[model samples]
Structures are given as structure tokens and as C-alpha cells.
Target: MSNKAQVLVIDDEPQIRKLLEITLESNGYEVSLAATAKEGIIIAANHPPDAIILDLGLPDESGHEVLIKLREWYINPVIILSVQSNEDDIVKALDNGANDYLVKPFRTGELLARIRSSLRIKISEENNPLITCGEMEFNLSARIVKKNNIIIKLTATEYTLISLMVKNEGKVLTHQYLLREVWGPGYINQSQYLRVFIAQLRKKIENDANHPEYIITESGVGYRFVCKE
Candidate 1:
């Protein structure tokens, strides 16, 4: 059999880290544990796992901070596993470099699915060049987004949603497509999230977010990105 997938679990709470270890090990993953972001970073730089699971409430430093530090060097996917369910927390983690997250008290099944999805994204991004839309550029190769010569921060979901639309520029992706691609098929019916995140992407990418020129709505259909002039 292939070697078990490697995962680094960073959380201050022993119970949370232990649970993650148990869940991941049982699911055929080799797990590493860190109780603080400081140690987490050291462990990550030394061992560089295939993926990372981080908690927002770290004992030494915030997970967002750790994410930023790791992102400077590590391109592997970082999934935030936090109890902080607020929109601000989610946005902060994603903007700082998290690939996805799970709300606290999450199900083992859901968590497993999320890890699988993240691994898929990491593999797909390998060897892919940057993608551009309008005045904005998404450097998939660099994991950076720039607009109008300025860096615009994007949450993981927001970035995923925008990247999908831009990659399929001019094609109106139905709500199902957007939802499934970003949030996964688990939230295919949550159409309102599409509205919220599209607005976020336009505000950061468009010359006039009020009347978007990059992302367009299709009335009864879904949204599409006009990537070419």
C-alpha cells in the first residue's frame, strides 16, 4: 500500500489535537501534533506535510499568523479547523492563506471529506500557471492575487469562487457549479453564499464594484466572469 498521507495538526487544546490525530490516523494518515503556532511552524518547516489542520485559538500565536508565515514558504494546503465561526474569523484565516475550514464540533465524515478536497486542490495547482481576469491576476503558481497593481486580500472561499469563474471566463456557471467547486457538493443548495462572495470578489477586483464589469449575473441563471476584453 502507498504510505499514509501526512498531516500536521496545530491546536492548543489537547483534546482537539488528540481527536484530530485519532481521526486522521484511522483514516490512513500519518499525523504530527503541535500545541502552539510557534512550534507548529517549526514542525511544518522541518517535516512539510501534505496538508495542515490548524486551530484559530493557538496558545502562542493566532493560527492566522501562522498561516501567513507558513504561506511565505510552504505551498501545501492549510485548512483552518476552528471554533471561531464568525464571518470575520473565516475571512481573516482565508485571506491570510488558509485553503478551507471546519466549524468546531465538526463531524468526522465532513472533516474527512474536506481533507480529501484540499489534497485534490494541492495536486491540481501543481504545474498550473497563473490565471488573469480583467485588471486582476490570480497567480495560482504563486498563490497570490493582485488587482490594479495592488494586492487584494481574498478569503479562501472568495478566492475559490473567483478563481473558478475566472478560469471559465464568460461561461455562466450555475449556482450548483460555483457552490460545488468552492464549498463542495455538501452546500450545493446554499445559493446566497454565491451572492455574498461574488460581491466580495468584485469589490476587490473591479474598477466599479457597484456595477461590476468582471463578474456578471445571469438573472435566472448563475454568475460568470468576463475575463477577456
Candidate 2:
């Protein structure tokens, strides 16, 4: 009966799989290896891991499709580790329910950090409704947001937008998803509307609107709410 956090590595590259197995095991985590999307999904379904490190390019099926299938039942974090660094692929993965994305030639330390962050967020979500990041605090139940212990005034739209981001902190929220959730299905293509509201939220919550620390822009994809602690 081992209590170590289990991490499943799903990659086609033997080298990548070996590297992750070593990195994760040495860092005190139990590891499972899979070279194909089919095998990976089966292993996950049998015994779910605390987190998953998945690659986009698979011989059997695309990792994006695999992620979609896993998200249907698996609620744990799924971090995309792939060679595809384009905005389209990144946005697609995030939209499909990946918790984080890292380029193929990534740093082991950073991957470990991402795994830790994702797992911690899972625990936090289950244990509390109050989310604190740097100088900000969000009381999900009361619908209150505070900065430096002072309540910040926010409109219904602003609060909804920020609340959505805060709830999924550390994970990228695609523009389409955010717009659809905050506004509606009709506003999914309204990127400009999202930008305006994001800017407004930053101005109210961020110490420096020009250089935001919490609501980070993911270039042409979307925004990722980071917890600065």
C-alpha cells in the first residue's frame, strides 16, 4: 500500500517515457508508462493516477482525442507534453480539458513543478472555496473578491469572469470557453469582448494593469490565472 502520488506517462518516444519514469520516480512518485493512447487510456481507467503527462503525437490516436476521452471520466490533472508548440494545438488541448501544456524539450524541474501545482489545486478545490493568490482573495460562496484584505468592487460580469478564472487557477482557459461561459454560446467568437473585460478585471485586481501577475495572457490562445504565492 504505497501512498506516493502516481503519475502516468503516455508518450510514443521510448526515450521520453524512460526520462519521465526516472524523473518522477526519483522525485518520490510512482510511475506508469504507456507508448500508445489506447494502452494509456486502459491503464488510467483501471487505476487512475494523481496526474498524467501526455504527448500529442501518438501512433494509435491523437493525444487530443485521448484527452477528450479521459476527461469524460478522469478528473485528475492532464498535462500535455508535446512537440506541437503552435497556438492552435495549445488552444485545442486546453479547450479539450488539459490542465497544462509543456513543449517536448521541456525541463524536468518545470514539469515536476507543474504536476505539483496541478495536484495542489485539485486538493484546494475540494477542501476550500476561498482562493488566495498573492494579494488577492476570492470567496466563491459569498461572491466576494478582496485585494490586500480590502474588498474590490466588481460588476456582475466582472465577478463572473474573475470567478471562473480563479476557480480553475493555474490552468489555461481558452477564449472560446471563457466567452461562452461568462457571456453565452453566442459570444464564443467575441474575442474583443473578452479582452475588454479581462483588461477591466486586471485594472481592478492587479497592482499594475500594464504588467499583470494574476490574469496572464496566453498570447493568441487565451488566459491562464496564476496563483502568485
Candidate 3:
């Protein structure tokens, strides 16, 4: 069996597909290509990739719909690579379960970095109690969080919020979802409440609260946690 991680590229544009294939292959990944949503779904179902590069525009069906269906069973990372840069489209895709989103005309270096981040997060989800990102470390079982080997004090709500975000590193957590998970169903509409808590979490975890490195604001959406590396 090949040790290389596999990446499935689903895009209608022949040039984009070709480019991705070459780029991914040269970077030590196995590549699969699909031009339409139907074909992509079939391929993914048969041989699930370690990660997916999905385009939002497809010939047979909407890529968003394809992402929704794939999320039903495929647990691996799904990164949306779309021309649609609108906030609504980005939010919808993230809420529908995309692991990450990169607008088209993206630099290959950045795309590679996103893929690496997604793959690393997926590989780290192996029922391990300890999760480490940059200087921060989390002990899920003991409910302890540390920065640079020193324990950091956090309130109950703050710990819960940080734990949730850490567990979902590299994926966007929408305002509604974050509120519902951390606060409850009643707080789904309370974006301000979420913002305040996020700010608090950043102050505790980030090196600079004003320019946070870990908890990133998605802008008009929610937040995404990323390890600074």
C-alpha cells in the first residue's frame, strides 16, 4: 500500500484539476480527479481520500450539495476551493461541514499549507487525551490546559469554549453552532455573547489578544482555531 496521503480533487475546470494533480503529486500525495459532483461522490464513496479539494461549482450538481452528502459518512477533511468568495457562501460551506475554505486564485503554497493543517488535525483526532497546538496543550480527560508548560487558569465556561475549539482545530465554528454548543439552544442568536467569550479565550490563550494567533475570527461568520506552528 502507498504511504502517501491521498487527495481527491473535484472540479469542473480541466485546467484546475490538472494543476492540482501535478501540484499534489509533486508534493508527495496521491491524487484523484472528478469533473462532476456525481463522479466525485462515486469516487469518494469507493475510495475515500485522506483529504478533499472540492470546488463549489460542478456540472452535475452543486458542490455544496456534494459536500453535504459526503459529510454524512466521510469523516476526513474536506477543504472547499471555490471561486465564490462571498461571506454567505463561505459560511454555508463551513456550516455544512467543510474543514476549510480557500477562494480560487489561491497561491499553491497557501493551499499546501491548508492541506497540511487539515491533515494534521485529522490525524491527531485518534482518541488521544492530550492535544498540543504550538505553545498550548490540552488534556481532555483531566480538563487541564497549559501554555508553555505552565497551567493556565480558566473559568468553567471559558474552559468549555476553548476545549470545543481546540477539538475542532482547522475547522470553522459558525456563530450559531458555537453558541448552541457552548451556551445552549437558547443562545443561538446571541452573537455578541459568543464574541465576548472568544475575546476572553484569546486573551488567555493567544500571545497577543489584539492579533490572535490561535482563535481566528472568520468575519461575519464565527471563528476557526489554528495552530500557529
Give the winner by TM-score: 3
Per-residue lDDT over 86-202 for candidate 3, one digit per residue giving the tens place of the 0 to 100 score:
778878898888988888889998788889989987887787889888899999999999999999999999999989988878777888888999999999988888888888888
CA lDDT for candidate 2: 0.90
Enumerate residue pairs that collide in model 2: none
Show model 2 residue runs off by greater than 4 Å. Answer: none
Among residues 3 or more apart in sequence or in different chains, the pairs in candidate 1 whose N, CA or C atoms overlap within 3 Å are: none
Candidate 1 runs further than 4 Å off: 126-229
lDDT of 3 at 185: 96
Cα misplacement distance, residue 108 of candidate 3 (Å): 2.6
| Cα lDDT for residue 193, candidate 2 | 93
lDDT of 1 by residue, 99-172 (tens): 76678989998688678867865655544567666678888756688987688888877877777766555444
- State, as a TM-score between 0 and 1, how close model 1 is to the true structure: 0.58
- Overall local distance difference test of candidate 1: 0.78
Quality of model 3 by C-alpha lDDT:
0.89
Cα shift from native, residue 33, model 3 (Å): 1.1
The lDDT for every candidate, in the order shown, is 0.78, 0.90, 0.89
As a whole number from 0 to 100, the lDDT of residue 10 in candidate 1 is 90
